[model samples]
Target chain A: MKPSDIFPTIRPWVEGLVDVWPAYIIKPQFASWQVLHILSLVVLGGVSILINLRLIGVGVTNESPSEVQRNLRPWMHVGVIGIIVSGVLIGMANAERLYDSVAFTVKMLALVAGVILTYGASLPTARADGRVSAGVRVWFLVGLAVFGLALFVFAGGELVNPGVWHMILAAALIVLIAAQGAAPVDLSGGPAGAGRGPVRGHPFHRQAGRLRAARPGKHRLCLGVPGVDLRPGGLAAVHRARSGERQAGQGHRLRHHPRLGRGRRRRAMDRLRLTHEEGPRGVGPSTTPGRGVRSVGRPGRGR
Target chain B: MLRDFLVWLQTELGKGPGEYPMSWSEALLGSLNFWGLLEGTHLLALMLFAGTIFVVDLRLLGVTFRRTPVSVLSQKVLPLTVFGFAIVIITGLALFYAKPLVYYHNIWFRAKLVFIAIALLNILLFHGRVQRNIAAWDTLAKPPTAARISAVASLSAWIIVITLGRFIAYDWYECGKPIPAWANVLQECAASEHGAASLAEVAQ
Candidate 1:
């Protein structure tokens, strides 16, 4: 349904809210309300980007996916609540103007979808063992794509045709989903590579054991290596394996995980991609190199 | 000499790019659709810039990410923050370029510049004075008073900047508009100076 149709029923409720709000806020040009909106975006948009980055597997590698999620969760709540409060304040104050503005309508729809996508798919994927199935990763990307479209429409103005842009965005997302399909889509239901116990002679487990035997200092040093290649997309499997590698000291081969090195990361990406292309369902030896955990990567998918 | 140079600079800057022989600047100036794209990007970049700073400021105040070393977290987030900052500055310049004279005379725009200068100074002071000792207290649940002070200052400055930046859209001192005396003094509000001339002529 179009936004215009939905607003009439809610108009009275919005007017009531506006009546109780501070008098200063009633003015459409109120500076304080505008500042609140910007500030809330700083919180909401910022945390959303960080959480989404982690979900896709490339932020704060030092922390476990769970740790990243836990630490950022409070801020996420604060941001979400702040945005809603400020958004409602602003929306109520200028309900008529917003009701008429297609940009506002697009923003509201995107906001709803964004909140759900962020909290539902992204946050859960992050909280899950960092080994998300490819299907789950697609869910995260879809949320990002939708949020981006909403932002584009809001910024582009209501006057512009959102229909054309929506179609363009949908096509782009479809391509991304199709590209991701080439990688293994996790169907086992649990974390992509969790549940299966440590495999003997497996790279991650073997390294973890070796590191455990080495000087205590080496464990910290080895852990430091992952930091070397922590680019923005360095999300789930590599990091998850890094932790497993740390504990088992065996996630990578003794030679060192190419994923950990800048030059070698492509091999890891290729391996993940190959898993998508080669095996859609069954787990293979190469399905997850470090301990049966496959995460989103393209750098090393060639192998 | 400096005053003369400043005047000369303003005079030169006032020349509308549209009048240039190449006409490329003019073409860009004439395009409302292009400016719309820039506006979209400017807002997006602001979100990124503001978001990164918010996290870093929180960490400085020792509110969250306590277990992780502050340095590591900073290192990881620095690139995104820088990328966001670069985009904001670029888009901001383009927006300013589109209507230089109007923006220059805008009170809120001036306020935004002042706020940005102060924020930058706050950053410099923190990195110079407080940050040297970061290693000592980076892991603490509550950072030292100095770091906390900088965090507060940075946050406050940025909020003011954002507030003033948004308010810049309001024309507090337009050419034909009757403005307050204080504004007149600050923005050279002599009626003869403004007359009924276009903003491009005023810039010249």
Candidate 2:
């Protein structure tokens, strides 16, 4: 069914509501709605950008995708609610004009596609906590392809007027490619290692330490131990030694080093108590804090 | 004195097909679909820029990313914010170049400029003063009072800037219209006699 046929049927209901409400009667009402719409879009688009960037292993590389999603979920909810309420009001005010606008039709379709891509595909795969499976990755590409196909069919396969769609498609393609390209290298503990890639003898050992420190609960434990150096270089040395032990089949020896040893580390951690007033010292401005003591006892697992 | 210079600058820039034959600003404004695309880019870049700033400001206010240290969030997110800011500035300049006189005479645009100035000053205050002691409160859910105040100032400034920016598209307080005396002074409508005469002609 063509959108032309569908829009006509819905036109009357919209027009009737517009007549009753007459949002345009007030001089500033429609403009206020526009401001609200754009503001909501800022929130929505910003959250989406950050999440997508994280998925591609670009920005906020320290936090796992799942954690980033958790942190941003409330803002996402706010953006969604604000956009919908303001969008509906704007639509009601301009029903007649929007009824015949091909751009508006394409926008609604694209909005639906975006929501699906984000929630159905991106969110689910991200929630996998960097272990995105081959199947899920394929599905993500498929979802992106569907959006492109929708644009082609609806917008007449031309680049005319809908330059925004072209930009969106190009950006999505770049993000997907980057994510896919980084996946294998990441598995081998490369600089882009976002997953649980082993860091044994990696050249980017310092970066690896910073990345690990970015994870929740790890940095706090590192900081809580008073004497142990919490600098990235210091952490990297510990990581390198532990990884070397693992590589040389000396996993058992990890228990001997005071820093890596589980029993001593825990005792050290227990001895130095942290009050909110006395924050961790000597930690650099860029070093992230841990979420809590959740990962204190269980150390050397992911790193 | 500034108003006089601005008016002179606008007059020089607005020279076009008749008198100057082919002016840069005139060419930009006359290009088909270029203005629309420029406006679209300006808005998109604004969203990206403002959105990233919003995230950072929220963090500073201790409203979000409480578990994460302020430094880490800033380190990771500020780069994206800078990227967005670059695009916003570039496109914003292009938008202004397209019609310098109109925007110069616009009350809302003037108000937007004031807020932008405030936002920039707040940013300076942040990086210069508030950030020096960030390590002390890096992991705290809430930052120091100065940092929080900076965040509030930044938020209010940007919000007002954006609202005023949106209002610029409306003709309610545009020049050549019956605006209040104070608004006329603020917009400096009298500074550009040539612009006012041209607008009067257009109005007729």
Indicate which candidate wins on lDDT: 2
- Reference-based TM-score of each model: 0.64, 0.69
Interface RMSD of 2: 2.8
Candidate 2 local lDDT, B1-204, one digit each (tens): 665555455456556557447556767888876777777777777777888788889988999888888888888888788877898898888888777778888889988888999999999989999999888999999998999999999988988888888889888766556566676677876664433323334456
Candidate 2 residue spans exceeding 4 A from truth: A1-6, A9-11, A22-27, A133-146, A153-303, B1-20, B192-204
In the order shown, the candidates' DockQ scores are 0.34, 0.36
Which candidate number has the best TM-score? Answer: 2
Writing each residue's lDDT as its tens digit, candidate 2 over A1-303 gives 234556567766766657655456532488887888889888887888887777655566667778888888788878878888888888877777777666666677677777768776777766776566777677667767767756765556233355565477557555433422222112324336554342323333344477567885453332222123223345434433332223334433433554666777566444232211223221223233432221111122122
lDDT by residue for model 1 over B59-133, one digit each (tens)?
A: 888887878777777777767788889989999988876666566666788778989999999989988998998
Q: lDDT of model 2 at residue B175? A: 59
| Interface root mean square deviation per prediction | 3.4, 2.8
